[model samples]
Target: MEFLQQNWHWATLAAVTGGWLLIDTVRAKADKTLLSAVEATMLINREDAVVIDVREQAEFAQGHIPNARHIPFSELESRKNELEKLRGLPLILCCASGARSGNAIATLKKAGFEKLFNLRGGIFEWEKAGQPLSRGSKNKDKEKGKKK
Candidate 1:
């Protein structure tokens, strides 16, 4: 007791750490699965994954993965047939953040796409990780035309 009294601060720290670990353990099962950029790269390469940008048409035109298929969330239901060619392949979904991509996943899953993935933090993380962004003024030109 004398030793513990002398090291009350250490005792408090230990107790807090243990409590945090306990909470983490309990929360682990409830955690959402997230794919980091590295894991996403592997999945793309190994599985020949098809990346789908589910942002708005303007957002997608601004930028997207080089070979990604642009299927804006608003148009997914109507454009479902366009993605038929990619069925059975792993599909990675992305948006500005992750909300739209998450929704895209639900839509695709319901549409019977067996393999689906949500880019953990979306294009934001992809850019932050210094991944290559697609080039070509072609898409941008179309976007500008729409504004006028």
Candidate 2:
């Protein structure tokens, strides 16, 4: 009790941090829309969900989920009309990591994308899970090299 009194500031900080972590965990769990790579794949295959890669062109060219439509985060607002056809289907958003897609989710939700999901760990997690990536531009580069 005396030690805690002496280290009250430290104790307070630890308690606050723990509380924040608990809240974050609970919030994440409550959000049933966040999908793991495997879950996203199942949705894609079974429900015909549309995968939208919110990463920039360069990041996307490196590799992305197969058949993912590239609409850089910056252009999502203006180019959202391009995705009107997919509004009724489940829309899975992804980026290099998960941050960009999280932001994209906000934009999409505002646009009435109800059946939306953010890839929990993005393409990095998908690759880590040994899921295949479609290297669109890279394959072109390789083919060009062969021609030369």
Candidate 3:
């Protein structure tokens, strides 16, 4: 008590630092669930993971992963049934960056999606990682499908 009163600023600093450390420890567990581009690719290759793009239809139409299911965030709740076929598979959620996909993961979890992941840095990172993308022909096919 005497030392604390003499150095109250030090005591306050110590308390604040301690609190931050505790919170960071808890957050580490939640954030550890994140996957790098390479790890995500390996999971897709070996585990036959399914990619779910949570971007808007226009964004998806612009470009997206081959075989990735297009389910906009607004429609995810109503379209949960559509993902039933992918229940057991590793669901990789992606967006322009990762923010939308992160939110999508939580939304799906609440809707009882047990297997899911947010693409770390999303398609932006995938391109940066030098992964392949569909060419003109395949891109045309997906665009035509969305028109109907």
Question: Could you say which candidate leads in TM-score?
Answer: 2
Error of 2 at 43 (Å): 0.7
For residues 74-137, what per-residue lDDT tens digits would candidate 3 score against the true structure? Answer: 8989998999888999999999899999999998899888878888888888879887654334
Weakest 10 consecutive residues, lDDT, candidate 1? 27-36
For residues 6-76, write the lDDT of model 2, one tens digit per residue: 99999999999999999989998999889999999999999999999999888999899988888999999
Candidate 3: list runs displaced more than 4 Å. Answer: 1-30, 135-139, 142-148
Residue pairs with clashing backbones, model 2: none
The candidate scoring highest on lDDT is 2
Q: For each candidate, give its TM-score against the true structure.
A: 0.71, 0.78, 0.71
What CA root-mean-square deviation does each model show from the true structure?
5.4, 3.5, 6.0
Candidate 1 has what TM-score? 0.71
| lDDT of every predicted structure (CA atoms) | 0.82, 0.92, 0.84
Number of backbone clashes in candidate 2: 0
Model 1, runs deviating above 4 Å: 1-33, 135-148
